[model samples]
Target: MDFRGRTVIELGAGTGIVGILAALLGGDVTITDLPMALDQIRENVRRNAAAVAAAAGRARVRALAWGRELSSFPRGYDVVLGADVVYEPRCFPALLATLRHLCGPRSVAFLSCGMRRELGAGRFFDTLLPPHFHVELLRRHDDTDVSLYRLTQQHDDTNVSL
Candidate 1:
C-alpha cells in the first residue's frame, strides 16, 4: 500500500521495527505498546530518525493499553498495524475494541499473527467477523507458521462475507 502522507499506528509495537519500517516507507507512524515497552520502542524510533525524516515521514512512541482509555488516542488513522498481537486470548476483546475505535470508514488494518492453535490465536478471527470487517490473506511464509491479513470495515450497504 502507498504509505506516502499516510498516518499510521502500530499496536503492541514490541520493538518498533514495523513502525520504523513504515516511517521509512513514507508513513507518519505512531508506535504504541504498554508503558513498560515505550523506552525500547523510543530508542528504535530514534535509531531510524534519519531515514524516517528523509522519507518525509515521522515516528513516535506511545503507551496504549487496549480498551482501558480509548479517548486518549487520536482516532481515524489511515492504517493500523500489529504484529503478533493475538497471542493472549484474554486480550482479544480489548484488542478488537481498540481496532474498532481507531479504524474509520476508509481505514485499513494489517495484522500479522502466528497460527498457533495452542495460543488461541485463531479466536481473533472469530471476534473480528461479527463487526462486519472484510478480511483477506495478505501473505504467508512457508518457513514459518505465520501469516498476515488485510482487514477493512465493510460498508453498511454491503452483503459480502469473508
Candidate 2:
C-alpha cells in the first residue's frame, strides 16, 4: 500500500520492526508498546534513523497499554499494524477496544496472530466480529504458523470490506 504522507501506528510493537519499516517506506509512524517496551522501541527507531531520514519519513516511540486510558493516542490513523498481538486471553477485550478506538470505517488494520490453541485465539475472533469490527484474512504463513488479518470498523449502516 501507499505509505507516502500517511499516518501509521503499530500496536504491541515488540521490537518496532513494522513501524521502522513503515517509516523507511515514507510513512509517518508511531511505534508503540507497553511502558516497559519503550526503551527497546526507541533503540530500534534509533538504529533505523538513517533509513527513515533517507526516505523522508518520521518515526516516534510511545507507550500505549490497551484498554487503559487512551487519551494520549491520536485518532483516525490510515492504517494500524499489529504483529503477534493476540496471544493473551485476558487481553482480547482490551485489544479490541483499542482497535475500535483507533480505527474509523475507512481505516485499515493489519493484525498478525499465531494460532495457538492455548492462547485462546478463537475466543479473540469471536469477540471481535460482531459489534466492533469486520475482519478478512490477508495471508497465512504455514511455516511460521502465523495468520495475518485485515480489519475494518463495522458501521451500523454499512458493511465494511477489507
Off by over 4 Å in 1: 158-162
lDDT of 1 at 129: 48
User: What are the per-residue Cα lDDT tens digits for candidate 1 across 34-88?
Assistant: 9999999998888889889998988989899998899988788999999999888
Model 1, position 53, has a per-residue lDDT of 94
Writing each residue's lDDT as its tens digit, candidate 2 over 110-157 gives 988897868878667665555777878878888977888888887776
Can you give the TM-score per candidate against the true fold? Answer: 0.91, 0.92
Alpha-carbon error at 94 in model 2, in Å? 0.6
> How many angstroms is residue 132 displaced in model 1 relative to the true structure, after the best TM-score fit?
3.4
Task: Assess each prediction's global lDDT (C-alpha) against the native.
Answer: 0.87, 0.86
